[model samples]
Target chain A: MANSVTAAKATRGINKTIIYIVCIGLAVLSILPFWIMFVNATRSTAEIQSGLSLLPSTHLKTNWDVLTSKSFDPLKGFLNSFIISASSTALSVYFSALTAYGLVVYNWKWRQAFFTFILCVMLIPTQASAIGFYKFMYQLHLNNSFLPLILPAIAAPAMVFFMRQYLLSTLSLEIVEASRIDGSGEFATFNRIILPLMTPALATQAIFAFVASWNNLFMPLILLTDKSKYTLPIMVSLLRGDIYKTEFGSIYMGLALTALPLFVIYFLLSRYIIAGVALGGVKE
Target chain B: MRRKGTINYAKYGYIFSIPFVLVFLVFALYPTLYTAFIGFTDMKGVIPKPVHILDNPFQNFKELIFDNASFRQSLSNTFILWITNFIPQIALALLLTAWFTNQRLNIKGQGMFKVLLYMPNIITASTIAVLFSTLFAFPMGPVNSLFDALGWSDAPIQFLQQKNTARGIVSFIQFWMWYGNTMIILIAGVMGINPALFEAAAIDGASGFQTFFRVTLPSLRTIMLFTLITSMVGGLQMFDIPQLFITPAGGPDNATLTTSVFIYGQAFKGAYMYNKAAAASMIMFVIAAALAALMFYLMRDRSEGQLRKKLRAQKKAAKAAARGM
Candidate 1:
C-alpha cells in the first residue's frame, strides 16, 4: 500500500510541474506581442522583413529623428489631443454627475420612462450615429473646431448610467432630506455637499472620459482636415513608411507618450475604476 | 417608510442629459431615420432625394439585392465579414476565460496581467487601426512571420489583400482587442461565485471539469449570455477599422467595407446623400433592436421552477459520476 501511494504522489508532483510550465508559457504568450513591438522598434526595417528581431537593437536616435519628422509634428499633435481630451472630460463628469443627481435626488412623472430612453440610447453603437454627427457638425461649421471631437464624448450614456448607480449606492436620502430641510437649494446642495462627497467616483469617471477623448481617432480623422489639428493616434498612423516601424526606441517612445498618461491615471485611480465597474454590476 | 412625492425633475434632469439626447437625436436618430427614408429614392450629391451620392444612392442597395453578379457577391462579402469576425471573437474569449480561471494553474499577478491585457481597449479608434495595419502587413509583419516560423507555409501571406483573408485578419485584430475585455467581465463573474460552493464540490471529489459544469457555469449563465449578446450587437456595427483602411482612394477592393462604413460612404464621401444613407442606418437600427430583444429573452428563464430543475440536474450528474456511470 505504501509503495502504490508513493508512485501516485510522485505522478501528481510531475503533473503539477507540467501545469506550472504551461501556465507561465501561456503568460509569456500573452505578452509576446508587446515585447515584439518594443524590440522591433530598435531594429532596422530590413532586419524585421528578413526575420524577427528577438533582441532589442540600439538604433534609438535614428528612430526618434524619423518619429519627429516635419510632416507629422508628433508633439503638436499630442498637445492638441490633450486640449481636446481635457475639455471633453471636464464637461462629461460635471454633466453626467449632475444628471444622475437630478434623477436620483429629485423625482418626476416620466423619470422611469426617460431613464429607460437613455439606456436604450446606450445600445446604439457609435457607427450608427457617425453620419448625422458629421453632417450636423458641417451644418454648424463646427467641423473645423475641436468641439466636434470633444463635445459628444462628454455626454456618454454609460457614464450617466455609472453615475446613477454610484449615487444610488452611496448617497443617503436622509442626508439629502436634511440638506433640503436646512434650506439649501437643490442645485446648491448638490454643488456644495454631494459633489464634495462624490470625489472618488468623479475622478475615475474623469479618467475614462479623458482616455476616451484622447484615444478618439475617428472623429478627429473625419472632422479635422488640416494635419495640424490631429490627435496622436492619427498622427502615428499618418506616420509614413519612410519613417519605419522597426526602429524600436522611437516607436516605444510614441507608444509610451500616448499610453503612459492613461496608464498612470488609471493605476492611480484604479480603486475608483474597480468600484465604478462594480457599481454597474451591483445594479444587476 | 412613507412614499416620496414626484418633484418634476425632468425639467432639471432633462436639461442635464439634453446634450446627449440631442446629439443622439440629431446625428443618430435623425440621420438613421433620414437615410432609411431616402434609400428608396435616387438621391445623390447635393441633390434632393434623387440626386447622386458619390456614386448612386439607391444603386448600391438595389444592386446589392437585385443586380445579377453584384447581388450575390456583395451579400456574400457582407456575410463573410459578419461571420468571420463574429464567430471567432466569442470562441477565443470563452477559451481564454476558461484558461485564465483555472485556479490550479496558479497564474501569477492576475490583476496586473488582466489590466495589461485590457490596455488595447482604451485604444478605441485610431490606435487599433494602426496597430492592426502594421501587424497584418504582407511579408514583413510579425503575424505572417510567426506563421512562417511555425512552418505553416513558406511564402508571406497577403492577409489584407484577398477579400476573405482581409475579413479574417481584420477580425483577428478585433478579436484580440475585444476578448480581453470579455475575459475581464467573465473574471468578475468568476470572482463573484460563492467559494463555498466550489469547496463543497471539492469535498465531493469532483474533478475540475465537473465542478466548473455543476457550479461555476450554471451560476454564470446570465453574465455569459450578456457577453454573447453584446458581442453580437457590437459585431454588427463594426465600422472604424474598415473605414480607416478605406482611404487613399482605395481599400482592399471594398471587401472590408462594413455596413456602417458603407453607409457613411454613401452619405458623406459617396454623395452627401443623407436620405439613402438614412435607409441603411434604419436597417442597422432594426437589426440592433431585434438582437437586444433576443438577448433579453435569453437572459430570463421561462419560469421560477427552472432553477430547481437545474439544481436537480446537478445533483443527478454528481450521483451518476460517483457511481462511475
Candidate 2:
C-alpha cells in the first residue's frame, strides 16, 4: 500500500508538471502573434522582410511617418470609432435596461408575449437583415451617416435579453412598490432606484457592447462609403488594398494601432470582462 | 373615501416599452421583413427603382440552389471551415476547462492565463486577418524566413496564393480566436455542476476521467447545448476575416468564400444583385432558425414535461371517478 501510494503521488506530480507546461505553452501561443506584430511594428520594412525577431527596434517613428503620410490616419480612425462605439454602447445599455425594467416591473397582459418576442429577436443575426437594411438606408439617404449605425443600437435584443435575465434574478418588485408609495413616478423610480441597482449588470454589458461596436466592421464597411467617416477596421482594410501593401512595417503599425485600444481596455477590466463572459454563459 | 384596491399599472408597461417597441419595429423587424419581401422581387443595380415582384417568387432561390456554383461552393466552404475549426476548438476548450476546474490539480495563476488567452478574441477580426496575411507574406515574409532558416523547404511557399493553405490559415485563425471564449464558457458550465455529484463520484471510487464523463458531462447538458447552438449560428455568419484577409475578397478560386461573403458580394460587389443577396439571407435565416429550434427541443425541461403528463393522467382518473359517482 505504501509503495502504491508513493507511485500515485509521483504520477500525480508528473501530471501536474505536464499540465503546467501545456498551459504555459498555450499562453505563449496566445500572446506570440501580438508580440510579433508589435515587434515588427518597430522594425523597418527591410528588417521585417528579412526575418522575424522577438525584440523591438527603433523604426517606430519611421513607421508612424509612413502610416500617417498615407491616406489612412490612425488618430482620426480612432476618433470615429470611439464616437460610434461610445454612442452605441450608451444607447444599448441604457435602453436595454429600461426595456428589461419595463418588462419586469409592470403587471401587464402583453408582458410575457413581449419578452418572448425579444427572445426570438435575439436569435436573428444582423447579417440576415443587412441587405434590406442597407437598401433602406440608401433609399433614405442615411448611408455615409452614423445615424443608421448608432440609432439602431437602441433596440439591441441580445442585450435586452441579458438585462432581462439579470433583472429577473436581482430585482425586487417591493422596491418599485415602495417608491410608488413614496409618491415617486414610475420612470423616476426606474431612473433612480432600478438603474442604480443594475450598475453591475450595466457595466458588464457596457463593456461587451463597447467592444462589439468598436470591432464592428460589416455594417460600417457597407454603409459608410466616405473615407473621412471611415472607422478603424475599414481603414485597416484599406491599408491592405492600397499601395501601402508593400510598406510592411507601417502595415504592422497600423494593425497594432487598431488593436491597441482594445488591449488597453482588456488589461484594465479583464477581471470584469472574463467574469461577464462566464456569467453570460451560466444563464444559458 | 377610496376603496382599497391595486392600481392599474398595465398601461405603464406599454408606456415604458414604447421606445423599445418602436425601435424594434422600425430597425429590427422591418428590415428582416423587407429582406424577405425583396427576395421575391427583381431588384438590382445601384439605382433604387420600383421593385416588381417576380412572376415566380422563388426564381432567385431556384437559380441559387440549382445554377449558382459560387453560392454552393461558398455554402460548403462555410461548413468546412466551421467544422474544421469548431471540432478542434471544442476539444481544446473542454480539455483546458477540465484541467482548470480540476479539484485535485488546482492550477495556480489561472487568472493571468485566462486574460492572456482571451486577448486575441478582443482584437478586430479585420486587423487579425491583415496581421496574419503580412506574417505569411509571399517570398520574403516572417513565416517564409522562419522556414528558410529551419531548412524546411527548398523554395518559399505562397501561403495565401494557394487554395488549401489559405483555407487552413483562415480556419486556424478562427480556431485560435474562439477557443479561449469556448474554454471560459465551459469552465463556467463545469463550475456550475453541483459539488454533491462530484462528492458522490469521488466516494464511489470514480477516477477523474470517469467522474468527468459521468458526473460533469451529464450535468452540463443545457450549457453545452447553448454553446453549440450559439457557435453554430456565429459560424454561419463568418465574414470579416475571410473578406479582409485576401485581395479580390475570397480569392485563390474563392476557397475561403463563406455564405455571408457570398451574400455580401451579391449585394455590394460587381452587379449589385440585391434580390439574390436577400434570397441568400433568407435561406441562411431558415438554417439558423432550424438550428435554434433543434436546441430548444434538446433543452426542453424533461422533468416539467413528465410532471405535466402525470398531472394529466391524474386528472383523467379523477374525471373517471366523478363519472362513476
Highest DockQ: which candidate? 2
- Per-residue alpha-carbon lDDT of model 2 for A118-175, expressed as tens digits? 7677777889999989988988999999999998899888898899888988988999
On residues B129-207, what C-alpha lDDT tens digit does candidate 2 reach at each position? 9889888889898889899999998899999999999999999999999999989999999888878999999999999
| Residues B1-325, model 1: lDDT tens digits | 1226534444766565567677656656675554454555555575334244445545645654475342244335555666675576656555555656777646556666566556566554555565556666667678788888889978888876786677666666676666557666776777788889988998999887788778878887888777766776777766667665434312577677667666666666745756545556666777788878787556544542574487569768978987784
Q: Given candidate 1, what's the lDDT at residue B177?
A: 68
lDDT of 1 by residue, A171-233 (tens): 998988798779897778889999989888898788777876787665676688777787887
Which portions of model 1 miss their true places by more than 4 Å? A1-26, A46-50, A240-283, B1-43, B46-64, B68-92, B95-107, B142-155, B245-254, B268-276, B297-325
Worst 10 residues of 1 chain B by lDDT: B67-76
**Weakest 10 consecutive residues of candidate 2 chain B by summed lDDT:** B1-10
lDDT of 2 at A24: 97
Error of 2 at B92 (Å): 0.5
Restricting to chain A, the TM-score for each candidate equals 0.83, 0.98
What is the DockQ for all candidates, taken in turn? 0.31, 0.77
Provide the lDDT at B306 for model 2. Answer: 89
